[model samples]
Target: MNRPHDPAPGASPAPRATDWIGTPVTADLLRGALDLERTEHGVLPHRLPARARAQCADGQLAMAEAQPSGVRLVFRTRAAAIELDTLRTKMAYQGAPPRPDGVYDLLVDGSLAGQASVTGGNVLMVDMTTGTAETRPGPVGTVRFTGLPDRVKDVEIWLPHNEITQLVALRTDAPVEAVPPGGRRVWLHHGSSISHGSDAASPTTTWPALAASLGDAELINLGLGGSALLDPFTARALRDTPADLVSVKIGINLVNTDLMRLRAFTPAVHGFLDTVREGHPTTPLLVVSPIHCPIHEDTPGPSAPDFSNLGAGKLQFRAAGDPAERAAGKLTLGVIREELSRIVKQRAADDPHLHYLDGLGLYGEADFAELPLPDQLHPDAATHRRIGARFAELAFGTGGAFAARPA
Candidate 1:
């Protein structure tokens, strides 16, 4: 493949549609998404079906589920050039530094081939203090990738994990068809912002995505940012989705959001696991506790943004709840990890396919000292890679929880 044709991320006039063939963005072409809702502008891919979305009016959950962490368009074609028209809605923190535009990753024949970012679409201005937001509409933009090999091959365009994207159209110089499944096991994962690819360089580089690539599994990522609080709707969605392997990374979001106390945490977890097993009985299911986060390790949350560096164009977070509150059953990461381990052990006796992974094993105190979380929450791009590599080894490697069994 030739060097990627990269234009800066910004608004540009779209190429005339008459020059290229247009393909409808349909469900068959989409992978890793549970539903596709038709909008006035285009079809928006959703990780959670409409029923699950209808049950929650929380804006955070709505945005996170629509961002499409692991969702991609996969097809077979000989097109030497491709253009995707998308209406992307990005978020901006009020009084804080502007976040980068989300990236669109292109893979040819299962390899990283090219990457691009769309410029203009929409922006959601958010006030961290007030928890309010305003939407500013912009023009739809196009992401173009050229100089692909002129031969029959598979192509995949992974959507940005942090942006709400609407597929306006797909244009190519040649015809395209859906790529049939290659029989790889499907790995479904659900977690918080870190697993949602918060600061990762691009979509395919997210830890869960990286682990899936290494494990040679198809990924369905439900890593909703700031919204993985063991919601019943989420568990129900998991229960209904089809998957050969499954994992749920729990704790950080619960602690940070202060969504529950010890009294509710145990039963919530059991219910979540029970729901998943209803659909995937005997399938390998792994339960992961929180990784090492110093701020929440001993202190309970209701985490708040630290605006001290706002003038310097940086944003950080602080655990606001008192450490003493743990005595009242308020949850902390330390408390969460212990409780999660106990819950899994108790259930595993009756569920042979169930397993537990201490998230500390993926990123422990030692790793933290070497590569601390940049914002005292989500991992940086380097840390994403590190965590992804370790997870692949421990979860998919020999004797691991998700290890392949003899047929």
Candidate 2:
């Protein structure tokens, strides 16, 4: 594993910078982040803030929040070349084979311009057998992009949605400045791994990212993998964040974690919405239930990993709880969907801006039959594109939940 110290075989040298100014990664230049925290190395973006993170010491939540899905470094620069150094914490299953490197996507003037990946970074070794994790420190890695248009233009370096990255340093051949806020509406979304771009091809390819692009909106994704459990802190975070459109994709995480039952679920949903409404009383708030997950559609969960394919370096998920538990108030996707629709309908009488979307509309049983989930859980790249396109049409198109109003 040699670090990428030099340019590729035929690549030209980066432009010489007599004055390479390093800008501090602050909240102003960061898009799609709800909060930022100072770390020992550098600034780390969080979907939830310090207060919210303090409430839950769950390792899963910590990891998910730090991953910075849909977050990017946005700035305007006239430089032809730009480089960013990041201290990434890459996860590795203790006994399983290593996974692929996370990708960094650079967009110029709102279009995909370049892409690259770093070499060395920290390793988070997770032992499945013992349920223990250890962090091994490693060298920081740099992602560099060269040969850009030599005119003043907007640049966005979208960090990997899957990796926990700490912004170590940024350098450019020319000076860079923050991009001013545009007239686009801000869309704030909260959900689970699917929304976090679990198996998406790249950072910008995530469903929410794609939807934001099609809707012509700014996106702040709070998609915490395996951690969207209707936590009060998360709701408060959403409540406080400024957004014109808000959405919370519920059910899948609740089902997979077996975190709550129907009895506690209704009130939790109400309370979460109540907190959000306190900040944006009239903002369009769309409640999205889980997509079609065959394993947990009618069955309760506490999903477990299927290790039968471990020898082949494949990990799959299966629902472990019984379907009969629904009678005891245990939750399932089907159960949660009904409850969510009922709750939204009851509240919409008093809160006209509130709405609900059955996630099955984005990825339903029929779609799943044609494009089966490879892991029996998360959707594949193609499915992500399909979902994103459908969501853009349903939620942001004309007369849709988040559609623009006529002047």
Candidate 3:
């Protein structure tokens, strides 16, 4: 995974497209491009130009938009920005900038006004920009807005970054269309950045997006990058919100972020699941463990290595699950793999409606060899597809189709 090295000085991770991919689009069929993501954190935002056709009368400004989740739009990039003059469909996700070479500047109205903001918006931000795609998808810059307004109307996008590439995803103020009563059931998925599409190639490629399309289910993706601590808020949110099919993908973030100890991991997990169960007593539930991340497989997690040495600032992280508890089978993926099964089994004995899927089944050693994360974390686009298709099969296909059967 030797990237040419970002034209920027230093940065990491420009990740996942949701498992939301459709067949690749041919170059000629494209109409115009609009960015569905971008903000202060890192990525930029785009508004469909009122006079786009006139603006690009020659042959430029290509884009497409889809509201996979109804409320959230996935903006795909093709050839946009006549000035930039270059665009590629390199898979982009919602994380850090793809490259670490140059300091990027943002543009508004064809003029350099500001940079994409990542935080303090109304909703969480997914991928907004990209840097490179290699081993695993490389590091790309992204901005996560906490909450966004209900609508926006504007046009223009510019990235004075490395200039290697200029693919994008911009957020809009448009409201997700309301679902008619008794429409397709809603499917809410919870998981790590992979579930969040850390750096696929674009927003729609996120697994949840892909699965949602395949299942024809409404989607509420709670895939938070660098989040998902099995915190009470998440559970409460699930309990308070609504869903017909719910699945929680846990593990990789726990291990990669190096959070929690075996002592607290199990109880926290139980409580999180417990809260979700409270929301929909009869909903089919699936609890997935981590996919194969060799970092934690044979090795006891809760291991911390120093990253400060590599970058400019002080850096350190404790892998999830404490050493002592991991050995006790309470914190390791091995532990989660077993415990998750036990949790559902014990619950299913009484619940009769619960199910489980080992993340290992989604993407493991074999898949890793085919596509590895450049940073030793996060999966690439190919892996996203592998996991998404596998998920639809295990969770929704066959008799287990996520579709509701006669009660």
In terms of TM-score, the best-performing candidate is 2
Residue pairs with clashing backbones, model 1: none
Considering lDDT, which of the candidate structures 1 and 2 is the better prediction for this target? Answer: 1
The residue pairs found clashing in candidate 2 are none
Model 3 CA lDDT for position 307: 48
lDDT of 2: 0.90
lDDT values for all models: 0.91, 0.90, 0.50
Per-residue accuracy of model 3 over 1-407 as CA lDDT, tens digit each: 11121112233222233411232122121211222333223222222222322343221112211111112212222211111111322322334333322222322222332233221112112222232323222333343221211223222232211122323333222322221233667887777667756545444456776677677676666665555668566676667657788888887656654567667777888888889889889888888888887667745655454443334322233354445655554456666687778777787888767787888888878888888754556676677777778887777787663855766
lDDT, model 3, position 199:
49
lDDT of 2 by residue, 1-407 (tens): 11244543345677666656678888889998878878888989988888998999999999999998999999999987777889999999876889888888889999998778898889999877688999999988988887688899999999999999999898888888999899999999999999999999889999999999999999999999999899999999999999999999998999989998888999999999999999999999999999999999989999998887876778899999999999999999999999999999999999999999999999999999999898888988899999999999999998789999987
User: What value of lDDT does candidate 1 attain over all alpha carbons?
Assistant: 0.91
Q: Using lDDT, give the best candidate's number.
A: 1
lDDT of 1 by residue, 1-407 (tens): 21123532442333355768899999989999999999999999999999999999999999999998999999999987789999999999898778888998999999998888888999999987788999999999988887687899999999999999999999987899998878999999999999999999999999999999999999999999999989989998898988999999999999988988999999999999988988999889999999999999999998899988976777889999999999999999999889988998999899988999999999999999999998899899999999999999999999999998999
Q: Write down the TM-score of every candidate.
A: 0.96, 0.97, 0.56
Number of the candidate with higher lDDT, 1 or 3: 1
lDDT of 3 at 69: 15
Ten-residue stretch with the least lDDT total in model 2: 1-10
